[model samples]
Target: MAVERNIKCVVAYDGTKYQGWQRLKNSDHTIQGKIEHVLSKMTNEKIEVMGSGRTDAGVHARWQVFNFHTRCQKSTKNMMDYMNQYLPEDIGVCQVEDVDLRFHSRFHAKKKTYIYRIWIGEYPPVFERKYVHVVTETLHLQKMKEAALLFIGEHDFQGFCSRKVKKSTVRKINHVQLKQEGHELTISVTGNGFLYNMVRIMVGTLIDIGKGTLTKETITEALDTKDRSKAGERAPAKGLILHDVSY
Candidate 1:
């Protein structure tokens, strides 16, 4: 019998039309499902691909990684060409490489960065509507920054995560910063790991602070209490993007 080997690949996808990165029953329009379908067709076998993490519905990824085991010894370039030819226009395999048999994309990741975009203007920009969350109300960037500072360091982020998450809520947030360029506000958060909806909820709470609806003290209280209701609304999925994952 021939020895099977593992192949690792980096991918990027525009998630405007797909239902995030995970595959679900009866869902043929998810990013993972679509990729697996094409890979299965190319390999002539049922190929199960594992992603580094799942991005929520309508969320986009600039660089995401995954791995799969294969029996055939095919060239990376050939596999890349075939994947692109069969994959939908929104998803693209950026690069392919042979990896160790024991390597797992999710477990090997060192950190992940997510960016939540906010458009604060009277009229939403036509070109960026698909990527940014439009908020007509003016925002105080300084206040948002102050609130963001409270999230730095390791903490049990139960309040910032959705209740649907089953994993441990303790995550180390390496940095949280808010930047503003014109009417665009970007919240970039780097963390060791995150729970479901963590970044989006954090962005929502900061937006609330910007709008004067929430205070810096409230953020501290939310973290201390570990209560979900004390935090701001969960921002829409369309505004959240997985910027990059580092290994």
Candidate 2:
């Protein structure tokens, strides 16, 4: 008998082509759907892969975790190799490990970090166009940094999310930071969890502040009043990358 075993996988993908991480009922062109289809074909049985969380369309991921129960007899290395060989070139299985049956990727996740990249040069980047958000205006790094600090700590982020949320908007932001190297600025945020478009909206607001379009009061009012309109623009999805999910 083929014994059921739990398998954990670390996935990395360039989200430029697909419709994000989750499966949509209407379309099968999704990351999860692609992986599931391949696995099901290889195993000759229906297979479902669960991810830590969903990444919005056009958002990339460096380390997304997922787990599933399988009866495939391939060794861990062979499993990883099989996925890499069959999966699309944009998505790759970084590693595969056998885990306890109780390991649930989403429920057991500890924290997730996301990074947004912005290009400050006037001329558009030639090669990195799809991977970064290019800002033509001069940005006030100090002002943006100050405003980003306010996002640190727990607060109600009702205004930060874009979806029709039924759950509480309160979430903890463990850290907020910005690092500039030449014309590229990387905005990194780590938190217990994130609302739909939370990171993208935050980045947009920060960019507005950097450009002197938005003020400190804007961030404060959004948090205090829980008004979505009080927040800044939601940054483009391509600039956001799932840095990692820590468990």
Candidate 3:
């Protein structure tokens, strides 16, 4: 009898066309569903791939970690090659390894970094339109930086999350870095875990601050009151990318 093995894989995808990362009952156009379909055929068993977390529709991922258990004896290299050969062109398998049976992709994840790109140029970024959010308003980067700093510590971000859940809304953010190069404004957030739409809301609030539409005190009030209405609107999903996942 073949031993069951935990197969870990890192994947990247241009999620422009898919219905997010999680599998759905009615839709076949999902990143997880596509990968799982290929794996099930490769392993000759019902394979269910577990992702580190779910990314909403139209959100891209540069590095997403996932794992599945299988009894197939194919080598890791062969498995990676087989998956890439069958998976769609938009989704690429970056790395594959045989992990311990106890290891889990979502449960063992220590940190995740998401990058939200904004184009603050006067002209349209034709080449990067799908990857960036174009903003025409005059933005104050210094003000945005000051507002981003307030999100570094742990807080009950009930105001930032759009979905109401029974779980605790308190989460610790390791860092929030904002960098501007020419017309590109990149906001990178590193956190242990994120709530639904939390990152987008944080970025949106910063953009509001940059435009002088919202004051920095809004962050304090939002954190204190845990009111969703206190935060800014959720940013577009296209601008958000799952940049990296750390074990």
Off by over 4 Å in 3: none
**Model 3: lDDT of residue 31:** 99
Clashing pairs in 3: none
Global fold similarity of model 3 (TM-score): 0.99
Model 1 lDDT on a 0 to 1 scale = 0.90
Candidate order (TM-score): 3, 2, 1
Per-residue lDDT for 23-91 in model 1, tens only?
A: 999899899999899888888779999999999999999888999998866789999999999898889
TM-score for all models, in order of appearance? 0.96, 0.98, 0.99
Return the clash pairs for model 1, or none.
Answer: none
Q: Give each model's whole-structure lDDT.
A: 0.90, 0.92, 0.95
- Candidate 3 residue 32 C-alpha distance from true site, Å: 0.5
Supply candidate 1's per-residue lDDT for 236.
94
Better of 2 and 3 by lDDT: 3
Q: List, residue by residue over 94-188, the lDDT tens digit for candidate 3.
A: 99999999999999999999999999978999998999999999999999999989998899999899978789999999999999999999999
- How well does candidate 2 score on lDDT at residue 233? 98
RMSD of 2: 0.9
